[model samples]
Target chain A: MIQAVLTAEARTPGAARLHAALMELKYEFIRLMRTRAYSLSVLGFPLMFYLLFGIGQRSSAAAQYVIAGYSCFGLGSACLFGIGLGIAFERAQGWLELKWASPMPRLVYLAAKMAASATFALIVMGLLIGLGVTAGRAHVSLAQAAELAGILLVGSIPFTALGLLVALIAPPKAAAGIINLVYIPVSFASGFWMPMRMLPHWLQAAAPALPTYHLGRLALGVFGLASGKHALEHWLVLASCSVLMFAAAWITFVRSEAKSP
Target chain B: MSATAPAIPAAAPPAPLARLREVTKRYGQLAALDRFSLTLRRGEVTALLGPNGAGKTTAVRLLLGLTRPDAGAAEVLGRDPRSSAARTAIGAMLQVANAPDTLSVREQIELFRSYYPRPLATAELLNRTGLAALERQRFGTLSGGQKQRVLFALAICGDPEVVFLDEPTVGLDIQTRRQVWSEVRALAAAGKAVLLTTHYLEEADALAHRIVLIERGRVVRAGTPHEIKHSIAARRIRCRTRLTAAVLRELPTVTGVEADRDGVVIFAHEPEQVLREMLPLDETIGDLEVSAASLEDAFLALTHTS
Candidate 1:
């Protein structure tokens, strides 16, 4: 009886690989949808912040600025906590070991995770835009909204890389706390909560060094809400930071894999 | 007890599915596997039997390519274990693992099924593991034994040529253990090669076609269960006697003795000689019985001797 059931052969190797990747992606998406706390933290917090601060401001200019700033904040958390904390917990629970033993491609596993994070980033951006137009009454054209959304999505790369680096190095129990420490301070110093000029003089001076600051500047630039001397400089800083963070993450991952049983 | 080697299988053996040649894996000063060698043959179940920390896991890890052996060669399906092609043809259930808590049994099965070129149908998997009724139950909600069955289901879902089950039934109840044992037997009966690691002497006795007894990173003995049992010269003699267990142990031919409500059970190379001395000394002796030594007794003798 068992032999009869074991006789079914697989499809072509190429098709099987493709099917496996798609299955992984689909399950990851399902996990995100089912995890309410993750959804609320990634999507709810940004929406709440936008509603509170963006709508509280009567001026259309302040409302538009709030939209861009909170969008970066929302997406940044979505990537950093979503991937970084998620992987850390998975590693601690031995899920990574099981996955490694499987025939799934390494790239496919990472792609699924990153794709899930990006999907959340897009959802958060959409909610913020909807709130900005209706409740906040901000003046923004379709082109502006589309451009800002593109910038936010691209801007998520550096943060995701940073998250991965932290997750690879931190113990699972401490991952969430460590991310919080990094997230809160980086967001505040990067001027995600307000304009750089409004922050303390020293923090404003230090803003350009932070990757979130560059992301914020680019996001604000799309809406004509930020005044930076060179837009290309912010892009350059972000690209360089992305490379550095990814390299760090790769090094940490390799070292840990070698050390673990 | 006969010390003679058991007869080798009369039929020609199938080609090897996996092999480890003089594999030496080390962790600092401790050698996890020291010049160890093993072969997993097609259509046979090999049990790697040992106590905890005896390097069963290290050997499994080396063969799975989870870790490289410090020296020696390891191969699966005639290819390096690390190769994707080699891995695609193998399935494993590690000692420690868990599926996503949010997913149901059916969902997790479907997810793992997609990883292999050839995978069992979801319905077939559920039916085989006796999880069809619990297919919709969340993984987090299942009992320990049920969870283990789920892992077992995933291990064979890929129709792997060689399946590695490392302590698959550990911590399960007797009924669950028997259920798992039957499934393992089914795997072998289906012509799949299986390498199972277990400390349960009964488990190895029941499921393994051949047992490899390892100690301190070396294969101390390897043979069929009957052969291994026959290799031990000890015979067991049980009798209700007035003599204390300590006095029974004092007998020259007695290697070991245990006293309980029923009687003093004596283990000896020459039980007849021990009995010759015992019947005269204990006039209260009754219910005397003699039997061949079991695999547990054999394991104790083998591990203690070398």
Candidate 2:
């Protein structure tokens, strides 16, 4: 009876893994989309801010400049709120334990969150570009627009990595509050809303420490609004941040797992 | 060769579908499971019956691979419980304070079903769980019992051969609790190995083919419900009498006396003899009731001596 009762399925095929991955992605997207507050603000924040300050008696460079800055802002918010808060809340709810008990690969759970965050970041960039072009009077060529989208897509990775660590550390009930505490200050310090030249000297000097500032530089460079730093330098910083944070988060996770017993 | 005959040899009994062999799990200095061992076979439901902090949930966690045992082995289908192949054959409904409330019941079931190679159809899972009418309802909007059913749907939707349910009926009403018991019985009837942990003694009596009473990481008693119940061999006499437990203990054939909200319940091998002595001494006795001893009496008796 035991032998017959057991599911004698063969090894998981590649197709099953692919299907699992896709399903994980689909649900991750749906999970975030249903949270009206999360989806609406992550999408609307950049567009609304651009309307407020990116246009009206703006220079051609200024309109484009605000587009680049707010696009980076949107990407940062999406990754932080979506990936960070999402993981923290799920982990707190004991939902992660159920997933771990299932046959779903652990990597798929993480990869889905990263992919979903990137998707939201890209959507916000699209919306911001549309707003900039129509009412804000900002001009963006197809090549530049593609470059902007690429920047957002890749730029979300380091933030995703950072989000992992935050999720691990933040208390579940206060995850949202804690994320905002870090998110708002870093965006302002990184000059996501204003040009670096206009920021206080200390703030500008401190901007390089945050990864979002590097992403901000990459976004600004699409419209030739970046400072004198080479575009390669920004890539190096972002890439290094992604690797380092991922390693740190992985180590932190492993240590916590060990300590639980 | 024909001289020796096999008259009526039955087929060999099936091996355990899931087992924890001499497992010891420790958290800091306190051992959650000390040399613990358990098994589940197909077509039978096993209940890990214990009070809170009695290591019942810890044993469930070890079997689910949510936590590793400090010593010994946890196995399912001849593989480590943590392995993907083993997990694919297993379903679990853990004690979660909140499931993701945003998704509708159907959506949650569908998502869990996608994790397995062979899964029950959405309609079938819905039908089995009795959630057909509420499939469109979000988990957040469900009552406590309905949410528990949704979790149960997620657990069984994978058509798993072995299922682990950790305190599945906690906080549920008695009617809902009975509904869960019926579902558990169905799982056993369908020949799926089911292991559930519960503090509810009646739940263990109603659902489990075998019950293991754990205390402080040790199995104090493990037997069939009938075997355990019959072992006490006592009748329960309940009454609001002026006689205290200390006074009741002096009487003959009195095995145990427990003070509860109902009243002072006296357990004895001869209830009539105890009553003859008790009633005259306390003429004020009221709400007198007598019945056969139950599992709770067996528990109180076990605790009194142990």
Candidate 3:
């Protein structure tokens, strides 16, 4: 259904129309980068998490675990932080109507927004990799480092899609609360904040249900830790979750744009 | 009726470029546009005029396809606004200039220009909107009027076939406002349809080929400015006369009369004939003044009465 809608928007939509949508996307991207909220959340929380968990701890094993956890959790937050919240705010403040009135292709607008958010997610991954290897003393092989980068890049999809979906349904100010409600508790439940071995059996059983949990387990694998024989299952779960979130977000976004004033 | 009348067959009046057929947007129980219907044509400017809750914004929103009419259809360029094909023909400048504050005005225009496939030159946009010198200034640092010009620049960047401007001159100085008015006129002259919503009566009266007066979510009157001004048909006559109250009341055309320090003002349907009758009775009508009905007065009478 989503593909059909996008395809229809593209059928003979002139270069000028798609260009207009891309321009709106570029503006949205640059605007998000310059905002204090985006800068602080993107760069600040990861730094704070690194300090409180990795450096502040005494044990090397604890520090290593913290490195893995903070890298996964912080990158997840970064993916959703600005794009979702910013979109919600734009909707609340009535900027969406301006876009609706322009000679811009609506699908291209969403496509560009997703692209911008993915770019920011890449920046967050780079921050995590630099901080994890340098200051946190997490030793890594070359293959593992590459895998970790790949994990951050691939793992960003679900959250980015989720952020778009949340922005679709939530009000601007409420987006932060909604994202936190989804991210923090899910991170804790998924054993990203603590080792799954140390978690209760019920939590261990339910962790795989979350996209973030699968992502964290995958990250643990990059750190040379065993994510169990069901690691393939985790991969499938994350892929399916990402697809589902993308579909949901796309549907909600279209409906919201259709109804917006 | 000349034989050489261009053999044009009088090209039947162009179909309305836009029309709202019984459109209504309801937020729960509040009707933003209560069964509103309006028409706009190519190369013509139609002003949407109303007070705060009179549904002017709602009508604009519906026409832009930002909000769907709960009951009716809003057709722009002969297509639903929600459709991309329909939207390509539109250029709009809503209330706020919500571009990134960090981007320079030039960057902002360039960015917006990229959204359209064939955009106007950035320099031309800046010059047309009167932002030539301020092009390199950051968006946040620009004054409100300057930002508005940039927004206008963005609106016209694509050179759309139809333009919707909602209060485009709200914060502008007189000179800036005049410039925007000329731009609006120029757009129409170039054969683009223009729809504007303004609180300024003069803007509607001066720029719009037709004015749509909305009150409480319904269009109470829609016609040329002349027709709208004459909608109420209440012309005023002021005379500094010593005519007795009985004499003024005796005139059948005088609908109402009240005394001011300088004179007795009369509101009559036929002010010219009524004042002529009173001329012989009061030679001391030194400060006498007569003015035809105005759009402002017409608006007050229409909206305030109903």
Candidate 4:
């Protein structure tokens, strides 16, 4: 009976693989949604920030620019806290040990997290655009709204790669503190909270090097609010940041695996 | 305590479902597993009994492909442990296995179930682990024992042929620990190859077909619990008697005697002879009981010899 049961287990490998990947993705999103703190902060921060800073302004231009800027902020927060702190906590609890030991493909685990991060970013972008055209009364056409959503959704990837780097470098207990210390200040200087042109000259010079700045510029470009002549340069910087961060994360993870329980 | 149930004999000799052949893992200058070898066969529970830092966790990690051995091969069903085919047939309940606090018990099981081609039914999996009633509870809300039961449920949900349980009952209350032991027995009875690593000797004695005592990354002794007990060649005689330690010590083959709250405990290689001599001399003798030296005694003796 035992032999028969063991022999009967492996059916079509392709079907099992596909189903496993989908289940992983589905549950990851479900879990993320159920987390009130994550859902509230990822969605709440930008919504709250937009309401406080964007509404009741003298002209709709400030409202329009802040809407685009806050969307980028929402997108980065979702990736950094969701993927960054989530992985560090999981690794600390030895949860990754169990997942690694399982038969689920490594790619499936990574893809599920990336997809969840993107989906969270998408929801934030969608809500912000809905409010941008209505309550904020920020003159956003439907075509421009679609373009803004496209920028933020595609923008989640570069931030997700950065999140992986945070997971690798930060200790679990101190991960949130470390990410916030760097993320918030960088977000401020990168024009996530406001336009960089009004910032001190030193921060404006450093803004171009930061990935958040590149992403913010991309989002603002949707509303004809971007200043720089070369739009493609922003994509190039974000892409380079993603590649470098991913490579560093991979190397650190491989080296850490060599010295484990 | 009595062994839970009689051991089932495999039909002919079974091939090892997993094996670590002379695996040596090192951390800088310190070697975690020094040419260590272990084997797991179907329908058998092989307990890797050792103290902390005895390389027990390293052995499990090597078999699970969580870490590669520095010098030797780790294989499951004749395939590299890191290979997808090999891992598909295996399941592990690690020391600190956990999931997101927000996920419900049922959701965690569902996610793990999807990883296998032939996972156990949701109801059966819950029922077997006594987790059906609490299936909808969030993982963070469960008590410590309940959390452990959920981890156990996840380990076997995959219908795995080879299960690695590293310290499966650590930090659990006695009742919950026994429950886990019985479930582990059920897994073996169903013909799965179970490899358990634990520092608790009675746990091994209760559930294992074989106990391998490890120390300093080496197998100091390996045998059935009965065989391990016999190496000491001594029995403990506990009785409610008026006999003094000095008097009991004079009995034939009496190696040592000590006072107990109830009465006296006499250690002797030939317990029957000692009892016969003590019964006639002490008219108040009652509650006489003789049992072989425990595995703890065997382990200490072997560690000393090695």
Candidate 5:
């Protein structure tokens, strides 16, 4: 029995690879759950912001807008801080080196992080939707709610790529602070806390350039709460940003490896 | 030949499990490994002994394919170390590594085991490493010794044919150090090739089948423990005597002397000659002790001159 268990052919290569990927996902999930401060902030901050600003509004439309805005804010924070700061800290700790030495595929490592961020995005969306329905007096059908949830979850990808770029470029010690600096400014400018029309003219014009702006627009468009002009263009811009950031991340990763051992 | 003569097949020596042939690795102006070479074979334990910055870690990194060598070749299981096939056949415990803090010991082991196509049973691994009782404890909460043992367990979880342990017991209490040493010995006894690196001379002498002493990116000496001890041809003589260190240094075979609380300790090339001369010079000499030089003494002598 031991001999059979020790043989290399005991399991198919494909099955073993899948098992390894799942294990990475499981462990990453466990790590995120155990870090109470990070989890609470990523999941709670946006909900708190929504409750404070959206709850007392007499206008249901205003409440709906705040819901859409903060949903983008919540998911963006999850991807940016979760992937960005997490990777930087792991590299500093030499955990990345250990993982590279193991037989675990590099893609699986990144995929696991992305999956965990997406899970958090779903949780934040669920909580925001619940608060919007009960306290904010927003009316939405089940289909619309599911569609908005899907959009927000999918919108997290671009931010995850951006986070990876930050992780690869910044020094680990300064990564968290730098990410926070970037997160707040970008979220505000992108109208994730308010509507783009309320900002300065120049800031409103530049809103479309930020991926968060495009993501929030898409979220609002799902409920017919905002203009749907060039919805495809919004997706195109976000997708293009994702592609560019991913390429930059890959380049930075290769360069760092060459610079080190 | 007569038909009744029995045919005898010629025996062949098995290939080395891992080899570094004239490998050279450099960082900026400093050469971490300069034209270094070593081989590891099945069921053999080879210890790379060196002081800090002696390039022992560099050599292990090159062999594990974590870093590429500048000049020559390194192979594991007769294939380039970078190949997945070669990597699958080996396991390594690096000098600087820690598992995820939130995961329990068993979870960590299970995760690592899933990476390999064939892995040892988790129960057996925990039992062998004496980690069964601490199976559910968080990795971050474990003591330093327990953490090292967990790393050891991960290194062997894959049932690797060759294992690399880079300074496995650098900082540990004596009892914990001994526990890790015995586990390493057990790995070799199971017919696996083991390569260990450490600056602790006693560790190398106690656990290694062959010791290779490295200094400044080159192997200064390589031999068995007995051969290394005899190579120096130095002996130490300690006795409670009235002679001062200055008088003892003047003896023919005595090269150095130091006065201690016990008496005077004499370092001599020939202990017998020193002994012959000592008794005649002092009538009150008593409680004499003569012993061969230890590996530590040999290590210092070799590294200091080169």
Candidate 6:
């Protein structure tokens, strides 16, 4: 009986509907790819950071640390940039209302958005990893590289959720300001540009509460470059954040739909 | 088969396409719709007519299940508008101006088409809307009228049983507006029910089988165009006499008088009676004329709020 209900629901979405939803998602990604802001967020900063800290003739140990840290930073950048900024622009232009009026299922629309966001995050991570393997000349084993990729993927989840939360809370006109406020502080506090140990005690204490901090720490651990006892704790924090963000976004979606005229 | 045989095997009687029973929508201190009741029959064209803020758009939103009424019931195609089945049966075009800039006209059409179970042929719709030449052009690059045409295409692309067009041609030129009118008329001819709200009184006069005129959240008048016109007093009379605006305003039959660039428009109930009165004041008046009451006059007369 459970299977029958699920199938009945699933069967309602015909091939055309799925194709349409995916096409909308593809259109969204392609449009973002053309915008200067998305370009800067994904490629500009990561490349500059990689060159400034990960690639130069600075201290070898410092460079390796920068490499791992910036890789995680790249993942976070993709999430906040792709999901956060994209939704704000859509809301500002009344596109979300149009979508709501259409026959497109809410799940389908959100699933497409999440898929596109993940794809962009993966691309940014790949570029950073390529730089690490080729120019950084890091001694990461094949297992370590696989583990790092897996960790980066997991790290993307919480940031994406956070981006969705921002999309719900902020109006489109104020989206850029709100996102800047969110991304800057979160990025700095996570110690992406510096090591957590170097920060003050209070900041270090607060680092575990942030998704980006946990993700960065997880990336460093996977590269076999750090010695930290709280890996499990950080992992738990990221998992909990992902769940919360998803829940908040779901509530926002339902509320917005109920509002009319 | 006999000529009277039912086209599709008749089962149970299908419900009324849309029904609103004393529906009222209030926002804060403002009432957008007050006890507005309307029933749209299946496969019929019902035109919603009024000035801005007359609650026409509000009523459309209520029928689309976008807005909940403060009181009374609203249903579409036998289900509450918020229900899945009702949404599936209805399509709408609102007055929002922006679409995503990167999507080409073809892409936009194709995308909307995917959202419905049954869709019209894209090529045919494009040709009908005169957008075939600009198929590959991005939506944002098109002129305002072209964009509106694309929206019209999207609204009907679903081939929904009931379609709502709210001020679909707000800024289109004469030619484009007529083109949209034809498309709407064609939809009605094809057995699709349409609920249209438009500012162009002539558009309603030309297309709507039944008209509902709203004012300040209430249906002040509802009937056919002829009925509405007949409800108001007959022929309008005006003369470009030296009658001062204040003096003209005193006449009981003169409902309104306003200055235009060329001359003043004196709205009066009896053209012959008012014309006879004006002749003594301006015997040399070259602009004296009597004309039949138009839909615009009827609208002004019925919907004039203090």
Per-residue alpha-carbon lDDT of candidate 5 for residues B65-90, written as tens digits (9 for 90 to 100)? 88888899999988888888887888
Q: Sort every candidate by DockQ, greatest first.
A: 4, 1, 5, 2, 6, 3
DockQ of each: 0.52, 0.45, 0.39, 0.55, 0.50, 0.39
Candidate achieving the largest TM-score: 2
| Candidate 3 local lDDT, B10-68, one digit each (tens) | 77655578889998887766777888998888889999888788888888888887777
DockQ of 4: 0.55
Model 4, residue A185: C-alpha shift (Å) = 0.9
Winner on DockQ between 1 and 5 is: 1
Model 6, residue B139: distance off in Å is 2.2
Runs with alpha carbons beyond 4 Å of true place in candidate 3? A1-26, A55-67, A134-136, A168-171, A177-186, A197-210, A235-261, B1-15, B22-31, B70-72, B238-251, B254-265, B276-288
* Weakest ten-residue segment in model 1 chain A by summed lDDT: A1-10
Residue runs of model 1 more than 4 Å from their true location after superposition: A1-12, B1-10, B238-265, B281-289
Error of 5 at A145 (Å): 3.9
Error of 3 at A246 (Å): 6.5
C-alpha local distance difference test of each model: 0.83, 0.84, 0.76, 0.85, 0.83, 0.76
Tens digits of lDDT, candidate 3, A219-261: 7876656547567877898889879988988788667655444
TM-scores of the candidates in the order shown: 0.89, 0.90, 0.82, 0.88, 0.88, 0.85
Tens-digit lDDT string for candidate 6 (A1-261): 533432232234555455666666776677667666776677778778887767763555565667677767777777776777677677667666666677776677666666676667667666766776688755556776678777877676787788888888788778778777777777778887887788889998997777787777777777555667579988898888899989998899668745534
lDDT for model 3 comes to 0.76
- Backbone clashes in model 2, listed as residue pairs: none
Worst 10 residues of 1 chain B by lDDT: B94-103
- Model 6 residue B192 CA deviation (Å) reads 1.5
In model 3, state the lDDT of residue A260: 40
Docking class of 6: acceptable
Comparing 3 and 5 by DockQ, which wins?
5
How well is each residue in B1-306 modelled by candidate 1, as lDDT tens digits? Answer: 366877678786877999899999887788888999999988899999887777898888877877888899999988888898888888889865556678889988988888887688889999988999999998889988899898899889989989999889977899888888888988888888999998788889988889999989999899999898877766899889998888888887788776656777788889989989988998988999999999998898788842
Our model 2 lands, by Cα RMSD against the true structure, at: 4.9
